[model samples]
Target: MNTLNYLHLDEKRVADVVTALHLLLADFQIHYTNLRGFHWDIKGHGFFVLHSKFEDLYNDTAEKIDEIAERILTLGSVPSNKFSDYLKVARIKEISGVTCGSEAVEHILSTYGHLIGEERKVLDLAAEAGDEVTVSLMSDYLKEQEKMVWMLTAFSSKTCGK
Candidate 1:
């Protein structure tokens, strides 16, 4: 009774996926904000590289935020739009004051780790609901993100010595 079932799907079964998507949306917003901070805060060596990288990340994060919010609407639920709501539900934490290039990249990598896991969980949920749209969305995001993780790791090797 709580769902609109516009897609002629079992709204009950997909509700869990909807809930998970809401959490993903919240986490993405926080992640986006953190990247914005990193873009502005990074300094020292590799500043040119990292600053632009952070900007690119935040721009992509903004697109993800829209995708997730729209997915929630597609699932017949409202996406949380407030920062207060985001902080309450997001597993990704807010980070700041990290101006070091290595540290900032490390933070972004760590954040991506958390996001990738969550996206997998969402993928499972969507598959269970027979939601191919959600599945494709997550799959694409995962592919792009995994590549980003690898690239960032490689980029960090020189400075972090990892």
Candidate 2:
């Protein structure tokens, strides 16, 4: 394919941003799965509440995952979605076994905090490298994660009080 290049971007910088974004996507996939699991397994008096919340969160994650992957594509990089790829790239761990609704809420809060930190780092790197698109994408993601962290933390504190 012969195409005239109009935009000049640093290949190395783009690669770095893509790498970081891929990692973020992987982490989101794992978190999305965890949310679904919580939605499925949640019980007790808070079942209705926890189920609804988890579904909403995971649905949003699904949408964000698509957007992140598209941003990676815009940077001329492929978005990885294989299970092995996610397992290798994700920094977050998948929790197993039974836990209460309150525990699920706490888990989500902690995960959201972790995501916020990771996204902040990615956004800073993109900014430093002049990758405005990636920086903007990460900034939006960070805001959403922060909101989730606050909401989940508030729920755990108010309802569980633990």
Candidate 3:
């Protein structure tokens, strides 16, 4: 008898994917809050550009958060909803009261770095579970976030040693 989930993935592998998904959900929640803070608090010469960008980021993250929760449900797991739970599972910490545009951007980059790493782990887990839906979703997120990281890195003053 095959011990597979309704989605046809191995039950154990589905459990692992669900665990990673919960972590990813927590990370997105933290990131969403930070983006909102940056949107509201940003000030300086780059304020106009960064303020709008932060709004866009938070909006996008909100959609991703919904998608993540729905995906968790599809995997037969419950998505965590409380902020306290998010704080416990998220690798990214809450960033508050950051007014400087550069500082906020730097924090955004760092948060994205954590998210990218976590997404990679989830991608691998989904692949192992033969979960094509999750694999596709994570792949799309990775592609978009990798571009965001590149663009944000370029916007910063720091440069790779030439």
Best by lDDT: 1
Candidate 3's residue-wise lDDT over 5-118, tens digit each? 445677777888989999999999999999999999988888999999999999999999999999998887789899999998788989899999889988988888888889
Task: Tell how far residue 110 is off in model 3, in angstroms.
Answer: 0.7
By TM-score, the better pick of 2 and 3 is 3
Q: Which residue runs of candidate 1 sit more than 4 Å off their true CA positions? A: 1-4, 159-162
Residues 1-162, model 1: lDDT tens digits: 534555766888898999999999988998999999999998899999889889999999999999999989878888877899999988999998889988988888999999999999999999998999999999999999999999999887755633
Q: Give the TM-score of candidate 1.
A: 0.94
Location of the lowest summed lDDT over 10 successive residues in candidate 2: 1-10
Q: TM-score for every candidate vs. truth? A: 0.94, 0.89, 0.92
In model 3, which regions exceed 4 Å deviation?
Answer: 1-6, 158-162
> For each candidate, how many residue pairs have backbone atoms clashing (under 3 Å)?
0, 0, 0
Q: After superposition, how far is residue 6 of candidate 1 from its true place, in Å?
A: 3.9
Model 2 reaches what TM-score against the true structure?
0.89
Given candidate 3, what's the lDDT at residue 53? 94
